[model samples]
Target chain A: MVKINGKEHEAAGKTIAQLVLDGGYKPERVAVELNLDIVPKAKYNDTVVKDGDSVEIVGFVGGG
Target chain B: MIPSKEEMFAALAERHGTDMQKKLSEASVAVCGLGGLGSNISIALARAGVGRLHIIDFDKVDISNLNRQQYFPDQLGIPKTEALEQTLSRIAPYCHITADTVKLTPDNIPSMLKDEKFICEAFDKADQKAMLVNTVLETYPDKYIVAGSGMAGTFSANLIHTRRVAGRFYLCGDEVNGVAEGEGLFASRVLVCAAHQAHMIIRLISGETEC
Candidate 1:
């Protein structure tokens, strides 16, 4: 199981883009950080998760 | 009589110990984006007696900004840096501030923050915030950057969190919310997030870096 936002999940063979959708975040609204480096929006479909790989998903808020 | 610069700064930092006071007085911070977060963060830092503040922003004050930004009605139509400098000087006379009315990008960030060990990223857009954070991490690997995200709308105030996202990067906000089309921004929530950045800068400069 791979970790998404610090929680374990079974996401074998799925691309980061798919994981972002599965996690209920809109593709355009969210930013994905695989391991430590940020995954550019263009590469979301190309990047995949491995077991124990940490992921962090964050979004922008309105106002300041 | 108004005290001298040194005397005023000392008075402002009087309650905090010598170490903290000295650290604050000697520290220089670059506060980017003088919007809601930048406005509050810079003012907070000034009140805390940070020595030199490099306030950068290129936008002019608009009426729409009154909802959550720290500008008054009389200051509308003026550049953010100018208005912020005027306000900061009135309230926090001891703070030595350099207001640069220039649009900051990944390229200018290094020069803007060259002498700063602490940076407060207060941009309004996610892309801008991400750009600044990424550039800073790549360039100023040793400097600490305090950024806020997911601070929009009027929701669970407790959800706003300040956590260390990387070795030298700290993030503050709910971490899940965004600017939904109809979602409204609460002034208090925005300021709550701003306070996190301000407090983090203070704590970091004071040698209390753990939390």
Candidate 2:
């Protein structure tokens, strides 16, 4: 299991792209951080989340 | 007649307490993107007697922005930095406001934000917000960044609050409501999130970082 936003999730080996999709977040509207490091949008499809990884996905909106 | 600087300072000190007012008067902050969030946040900080502000934005005041942003009908077509500076000067005559009308990027952010220790991320687009947050996190390790997000729709104001994301980063808003979700951005909801950001900044300036 992996930790997403401090919660335990059954997503040990999923890519960041898959995690965002599973979480129902628009791929373009969210920013991901893995273990305190930012994951670029272009690299989300290739970067995978390990069992102990902690992810923070911050979804953004257009309005200020 | 406008109050003298000493009178204004005394009034603020009376309202905020002498110690907190001193900290606020000595503090400096940078606000990027003078939109609904940034404009309102800047106004709140100014009214609270923040000593200096570095305001940055490339856009101008458009008519549509009147729906939620803090701009007057007569100020349309002017650069946001200039308009906000004019407004702030009237609100807090002793407050120092430095404005730059340039589009911020990962390249220019470091140089532009070098002076202020506290940064407020108030950009409108999702990608731009991410870019600013990511750049600040990777570049300025010591400075604090307060960002706004998910403040859209007619959701309850109670949800629009602050969360400490990292050691020096704070996120404020509902965290779920978004204009991209087919909901609208109303003045009340947007100002609620902006108030949270302004309050968090005030707390940070007062050394109350734990939240």
**lDDT tens digits, residue span B1-211, model 1:** 6678867756765777667778888999999899889999998988888888999999999998988888999999999999999989987787788999998886788787788899998988777777777677777658988888888777898999898775677888887666645566677998999999999999899777755
lDDT by residue (tens digit), candidate 2, B71-161: 9999999998989999999999899999999999989998999989899999988878878887787778789889999898987999888
User: Which number leads on DockQ?
Assistant: 2
> Would you list the C-alpha lDDT of every candidate in the order shown?
0.82, 0.89
Clashes of each: 0, 0
Which of the CAPRI classes, incorrect, acceptable, medium or high, describes model 2?
medium
Candidate 1's docking class is acceptable
Residue B28, candidate 1: alpha-carbon lDDT: 93
TM-score of 1: 0.86
Model 1: per-residue Cα lDDT over A1-64, one tens digit each: 8888788889867898899888776665555678876676668899988888888876554447
